[model samples]
Target: MAGKQASVLVQYIAVRGDLAEKWPMGAIIAQACHAATAVMHVFKDDPNTVQYLSDLDRMHKIILKVPNEGELNALVSVLESNNKDFKLWVEQPENYPTCLATKPYIKTEIQDYFKKFKLLK
Candidate 1:
């Protein structure tokens, strides 16, 4: 199961990377957020999804390493779209953990967003 999950995560990351390269920064972030959110949904109900979440965690770290308003805004936009309340919490640096905890929801929102955006087949 873990192996299968890992494979799925790898696929997701590869797709995300491709999107990042091809799309605008905001669009990439939006797509990544959507992808991560989809993974979260799968993770919540399927043990297979947990590995994908782990992949997302790693990707999140990479995203954080980037220094740009467009990137940050895109990331924050996804979070905000997932949870309106997150806007307030995200503003407070100390509440980062709380914001992290909301990743699942953010991920789920991203998944839905992807569907709406027609990023998913």
Candidate 2:
């Protein structure tokens, strides 16, 4: 198994579910986009990111929801403590910390950190 490679790389984005009640859908979606884009740019040189980006059609992303800003804030600490590479996007005009996006990583290695969240449906 020494030479085995992880075939599926996924990026995980977590958004604040409470925002749905306070903001328009477009605004919430934009925040997620900002976080995802920021992390990708920050880790553009990483091997997994490079491989994840190269396959444009197959790029995979899972967006989940945290109950509120408190949950989103806690996730930052969790990711930081675990040494996960990610971007926590704070909207400028309002200085609102909206969401976070993890750099593309092996699903099995990183999914556990996000297991508590539910898909944003």
Candidate 3:
């Protein structure tokens, strides 16, 4: 009999640097939060998400930054082509894409998609 192996689940969030540079810190954080929340809600029933939430104290997230909206959109394109599950949050009224976040997934399973980006400081 084989025992179940443990996996490191992580949520990836990419926010537009241009927005973060110009917008208030709170607003920038809000964009990332919106994307994160949306993806989690959208994928709440996913196996990885379920396991990720099952251990809330160990939840892991990687926050990266894109230079601008175009760069962020470019990342989204790659994610879509790879069939990665994510939420691209577009603020209404202004209709601007501000941030994107992937649902909780095994780190190794999706790390390649974000290797080119740097962590958001």
Candidate 4:
């Protein structure tokens, strides 16, 4: 017998490990927050986002770590090619690319794209 699949929406966040190491913890956390908020604002009208917001308390997100700016750029480029909507947050003045975030998406639909990355530890 086949088991029924569950459709769960997840927000994907990718942060540069180099920045996390070099900067203070609060600064690194701020970058992730900026990316996540930016993506949410950009995709607020999307159905998945709407649904995800409807249950704010239970919303789920998977935070991943990218080794450095090169890896962050590579991930964003792939997301662009696949037409996957995401926000890449760049800190100003300092001119730094810090984090990336994808709008809420069905797990099965986008999970493979992030399979190689590990959860932020």
How many residue pairs in model 4 have overlapping backbones?
0
Q: lDDT by residue for model 4 over 1-121, one digit each (tens)?
A: 1222347889999999887778888888889999999999999999999999999898899999999999999998899999999999999988878999999998888888899998887
Ranking by lDDT: 2, 3, 4, 1
* Worst ten in a row by lDDT for model 1: 95-104
On a 0 to 1 TM-score scale, where does candidate 3 land against the true structure?
Answer: 0.93
Off by over 4 Å in 4: 1-5
- Please give the lDDT score at residue 44 for candidate 2: 94
Off by over 4 Å in 1: 1-12, 16-22, 48-121
My TM-score estimates for the predictions, one after another, are 0.28, 0.92, 0.93, 0.93
Look at candidate 3 and tell me the lDDT of residue 107: 81
Off by over 4 Å in 3: 1-6
- CA lDDT, every model vs. true structure: 0.36, 0.92, 0.91, 0.90
Minimum summed lDDT over a 10-residue window in model 4 is located at: 1-10
Model 2 segments more than 4 A misplaced: 1-6
User: If both were scored by TM-score, which would come out higher, candidate 1 or candidate 4?
Assistant: 4
What tens-digit string does per-residue lDDT give for candidate 3 at 20-114? 88889899898899999999999999998999999889899999988898899899999999999999999999999999999998887899989
**How well is each residue in 1-121 modelled by candidate 1, as lDDT tens digits?**
7664333322222122333444577654554455445545544754444544556445331132222334444545765666522221131343321111122333433444223222222
